[model samples]
Target: MFKDTNQEDYGSTRVEKDSIGEKKIAADSYYGINSIRARENFNISRENVHPELIRSIAVIKQAAAATNYELGLLEEGKKDAILEACSEIINSNVAEELKLDAFQGGAGTSTNMLVNEIAANRALEILGHKKGDYHIIHPNDDLNKGQSTNDVYPTALRIAVLKLLVPLTESVSKLQSALQAKEKEFSSIIKLGRTQLQDAVPITLGQEFSAYAEAVNRDRWRLYKITDRLKKINLGGTAVGTGLNTSHSYIFKIAKQLRNFSGLSLSHSENMIDITQNMDIFVEVSGLLKAAAVNLNKIASDLRLLASGPAGGIGEIRLPAVQAGSSIMPGKVNPVICEMINQLSIEVICCDQAITMAARDGQLELNAFGPLIASKILKSLEMMKNGIDKFVDKCIKGIEVNQDRCQQILDNSLAVITSLVPYIGYDQASILAREVRESDKTLRELIVEKNIFSKSELEEILKIENMTSPGRKK
Candidate 1:
């Protein structure tokens, strides 16, 4: 067992050479020379490329193989091997083994080459050849036939982003549903609404939650709109969008094949050059994601404040306690999930800034920062999704209303006097508001004591449901 372990660790290394130099590789590594050099050179970020992107690259390679076979550029056996290898990468959990950093230069050449080498070597193994025996199925010449890093990298990035959007959109929908359910549940529960951190008017707790649901629904719609924009890819625009060594037939057919394979409504960009150089679409998507983050932060902050205290703060709502909030306090429970969402939103907003800068820094022909852009946006989407799911399940669904507290606050607020303005003159309402605030009398008490109207009439006018909507203008 010791000898076998030694062989697995040391004796399994094989030599593979490239233009720069040669390096010893693990015998069973799907990646070849370029990937090994990239791993050594790009020691930045220490994180593996996102697995969604890995799957996206494999999906593209599989589509390319099918297109190449249809165009008679690849033999059926070679195409079969490539397709099988891509399926293996997609279906298996092999992403951690790729080892390419998400921060690299060369307009994503290292990433594209990394995927190419993995697919090529895996195909070679499928054909009963050793990993570096690329003479039988060369990574560049055959596996990456008619494609370039410039084209393939952005195309795969779009596919990966689009793929993630499906789940992210679903998560947002779930959040909206959760908020909507709370709205319906709390619809009749009256609470004091505020502006400028001061009391303003009476509103149903349901209306507040309804607004949150609507905001999330709008975000879901925006996500769908951006997904349509991401479907336009520059797949056939090799090296510089001139389709240099690739034929028009291959260019057009690749899109069709990719659409078929990915089940996405994909199309080739009409101006491949523009697609290759301009990353504005990614920036637009990031901006929309930031908008959702803003909404999330606002909602989370509101929940934290509403759940702030049972004794000191605006203890209008109770959030479900998932864990002990304080280490030292005897009976302390905290709004931890809301705080987590707040921090996640901040992180997403920061990631959007990084993506915006990377998109802006692209020079002519290619952006060397594609990897950075992909990493930021993917991380933002995934983090937001996970955060949203947990928030909905643990926090939103279990929230309980403090009904008596809400009524006590509402009865004491002077802002509810606005509901009396239509019944009384504005001047009278103002004086009454000042008198009520200065004395030890509540709004309901003063109205009853003064006999401003009959008790039943005042009760009818100050009804919570009547105050929530428009009444006769005076």
Candidate 2:
């Protein structure tokens, strides 16, 4: 049964019905009955489907319009109207109006229909017709012709993910470059390296930062590789990946049009059936995201620990005091940026777990959790990108090493005895380290006073360059 309610307060009204029931929509609403039902049924997460995904869906719709028009399957006027409407969505913020839930059910069928209804109603308007006039320009018959949610949804999901990764990769690369610059700038500043939270040996602050840069470099490389994986699409594999209702000729044409429209290296998957049934690619992507998150967490934790105390903790480096550390402790500063990134990484890790489980939960021909997987992966990518940008600007680029503290700790610690084990035997070096620690004497003080080696020899052996690198001592 269809029920019509007065929509005067909302705007001019339109009545639309689907198989399940009917409802009233705002007169100018670009979405129709199916989208309205989705919004009502999946009020789980208030968040909308990602804008990038919505844009990708528009691109797919526009590409389909062009392909169908070229094949003479659709008239010129309908194709032009569909293209114009999809362009409105691609170029404008039209998706904000759809408001389909991010955590919707039905393996993203609701999302696919949301895009279809918007495109159809908007195309109707473009053709100077009213919304819900499906006979003239139907959502399924015209806008989503030759496609299924199974094929279209995942294809759009891959495109949106690929697009989002561009900015993410750039953000990570910027962070890596900043860290590399810090490495070069701090190259001459010596500090004590630690293992298992115990002082181990002498190293330059530059080396520590260089390790971080290298870790990020690996993450950047991984992002590029996974983006290539996302390019293998399933656009032509209608309904269970068998090209059931779609003509054979239009299959590759749709892929071509999509590639041209989206400017991606998109190709139809070799085995569309396998792609339709499995979501392993997303699992691989989630794993990469998890790895990057782990690196960010480790680096942030290191920064927080190193910046822990101006008077109590390691205090090897000073992070920018962007905000007050505490309300009660006067003059207290916190590593808030690092802590924020640390927490963001934990969230990303949890998102990876969600994605992994969603990917694994697919039934015979489709996964009912595609929307959840897509939403979580995209959210993780966006969160990581934003977190990294802030971390670089607010923390990494503003970090300043406590040079005197580094040198003082380096000179006083018995860990510098590691450098001496090469010249002196390990047994002698161990004895000297124990004596230096028990007597509370600096390594240089004890060495010089005991005449362990000449001042020139000590200077050469203890040089940071020699200790940090594998080369003969000067």
Candidate 3:
């Protein structure tokens, strides 16, 4: 119905008909009727489903085909054709053929159909048949035998997410190691610590960086452990978590084949209905992602504040200047890398919110929101991995502590009074602090003027090592 007389409009069009009607698709295109309808119906995201997701679905089809052939359901020639087609998809970079929007309705029905159609047509070509000649290797009858979209979509997403998490954990570990290196680098540089944004006490910059490193270490562990929860899949559940047309043997044997194909220790869901109906595991994973984002955001904000200025602001640490910050301000550089991390964290947090809400809004038997959840979760994982790597390379590794600035600020600030309070008493120290703040004199000048302690005694009390340690330096 959407076709024009000019066949060149669709680049040599072929008529592919579905129950809804028929439309003209590219003659040489692997995608068929369902894909054409989806392209016309859903152009929301305008971005293709991720390549990993497509490849993951191909693995599912390949494994399913092998299982079916073993069970005496699929013929040998059809199985071989499907295997070769799926293998080419996994190894080659022909993701363009599976052109469906990542974010769409029907709970990934269109995506499942797109994959089925592409695989079926590819298998047809392998068996010396033209596209749309699905009579030989039908999309649903052969390629999707004993499977449903509800089962296939979530299984593919789990596989893709598991593959995605490997690099994410590695990037987080690298970020933690980078922070640890900085912690050791700044271990001896004592700086003024702030509580509620006011001068409170003295602490080494190393201690602060240690806190960051420990936070990131926790994030790494959290991301690493969540794979177990994702390993359980409702693949054989069919329509409503009942085996439906699928045999019990097929239900049990598919997991082994899938594990072999994907190289993951995947297991079948104990309660397929629950796994299919309730999507809480994804929400749990998103919660951990939110935590990781929170940590990255906090660290990035602190780095930007610490690297505020070379002349004004805190100026305690210098970040690597990677670009010109402003057009009008001369010789100015901003914390672009840290800001990038902050922005990425914000987006990850937003993606998590969408995932949580979509998961919660699932209907009676199906979520109908798998597309949203999958896209957000996968995007969050990918961006976090990329952002953390960039942050480690451009910012954390290049950070240089301003030892002179730290010493100068501590020399003039009132935080050092905490160090002297033990010997001078809290009342005397409070009085000295108040007087120094009110008057123009520095803490050192006031202490020397009042003879609170002798000059040598004050110097000894205010030593960087002594001030930063506790309980009389052990």
Candidate 4:
């Protein structure tokens, strides 16, 4: 036989080679080796799992492990090991260090792998060993034990929505507050109310601001309603909807654990099969987001229109100078911030369509496109949050009413057609309105030309308060 040349010398010992002529590795050399296979296997990337969703998944895993430990489903050593691992991951130093791409397949399998590797390493550290030793807590058998991607992914999605709902509600509330303040400040001011873009009647600026506030209030309530549904989680319905391989005790234990960890008043869903197969809940939430986007878009449009121009536009409101509006036009400050918000709102509306399509694409037992749903929903949430903050700080809070301009428009307005009612009577007032429109004459000039009332009488009668107050002048 020829002398074998595949063997390698390490110090004084000869290390034997494998069939492929590769040297055998020590146990430490193969740390976290399983994650490589997981990473490669689930490589279908239509969309990336968002960071917010990842944090949500980590939270759910921590909650489940804590609950199982508390309920005695796990022994003391294993419970401590698991909790220690979860705590380390939760308070990890390497969270910011993770630079992997977010678009792994299988509804965030790469994310799952990342979480598992981090948690496993943390668990090993707690057990007085080096990281990536799968003995104390294997990523699958221990860290992700008693759970499946089906349950975990959906649970994480819901929890992410729940967490986001708080900030969203706060932002809406702040907008409402700003509107209320504007209403009070503009209470005495009157402006022409337009119907079909034509001057109709005189209305207080306060009334207009109040309407904006009320619209946001309605959107806030809509968000609250959808967020209530997010409280239901499918943590125990591992793999499929049946909870087959999981013990009944384990299901309840995990739910209870999650409740304590998240402090969200979470509970197990009643129909696990329906929850697994249907993404209707996500659609409902996205619909609410679309509703919010519509309201915000409308508000932003109104802001732009109301702040239209210093010379040619409505010029009824003035926005603070946040930045230069144009590069070529000197002293040109545009409503660019509100425009940005409007564009963001449009994108949010489109994301809602993506959510609707993803929900409808679900097949019999599994919705194979969950990763897209998670991605779209999270994007909607973050964009809405950012838009709300910018609109508030850059536009709403800095808004100043152009009092002189408002009064100029109001004085020239033919909206005073109602003022002639008490003096010229309804029929004569109607004629005067028609005549004013036909001749394009100011309401005050018409009242004076027809001598409908004495000048002093007209002055007292045409006061803005007389028009806006619910009570008629005696």
Tens-digit lDDT track of model 2 for 17-63: 77877788887667688877777788887788998888899899999
Residue-level lDDT of model 1, residues 1-474, one tens digit each, is 001112236557888888777778777777678876777788877676888888888888888999999989999999999998888777776654556788887878888888788888878888989878878999998878989989999999999899899899999999999999999999999999999889999999999999999999999999998887899999999988889988889999999999987889899998999889989898999999999999999999999998888889899999999999888997899999999999999999999999999999999988888988999999898998999999999999999999999998887777668888877889999999888879998878888889898888877877777788876433
Instruction: Return the TM-score for each candidate structure.
Output: 0.95, 0.95, 0.95, 0.85
lDDT of every model, 2 decimals: 0.87, 0.87, 0.87, 0.74
Enumerate residue pairs that collide in model 3: none
Better of 1 and 4 by TM-score: 1
TM-score pick, better of 3 and 4: 3
Model 1 residue runs over 4 Å out of place are 1-9, 444-456
Question: Per-residue error at 138 for model 4, in Å?
Answer: 1.7
What are the per-model C-alpha RMSD values against the true structure? 2.7, 2.9, 2.8, 6.8
Top-down TM-score ranking: 3, 1, 2, 4
What TM-score does prediction 2 earn? 0.95
How well does model 1 score by local distance difference test? 0.87
Q: Model 1 — TM-score against the truth?
A: 0.95
TM-score, cand. 4 vs. native: 0.85
- Residue 287 CA error for candidate 1 (Å)? 1.0
Q: Which lDDT tens digits does candidate 4 get at residues 1-474?
A: 111112132233222232335333223321243444443454465344565666666777687676666666555676676666655545553343433344445655556656765666666666777654565667777668778888888888888788888898889889889989988998988888778878778988889889889999998988888877788777889877789678888788788878777678888988887788888998999988898888888888888888998899999999888998888999999998889988988898898898899889888888877877887888888888878988888888889889899889887777877776766689988888788778967777777887777788888888777787676666
Least accurate 10 contiguous residues by lDDT in model 2: 1-10
- For candidate 3, the per-residue lDDT at 306 reads 81
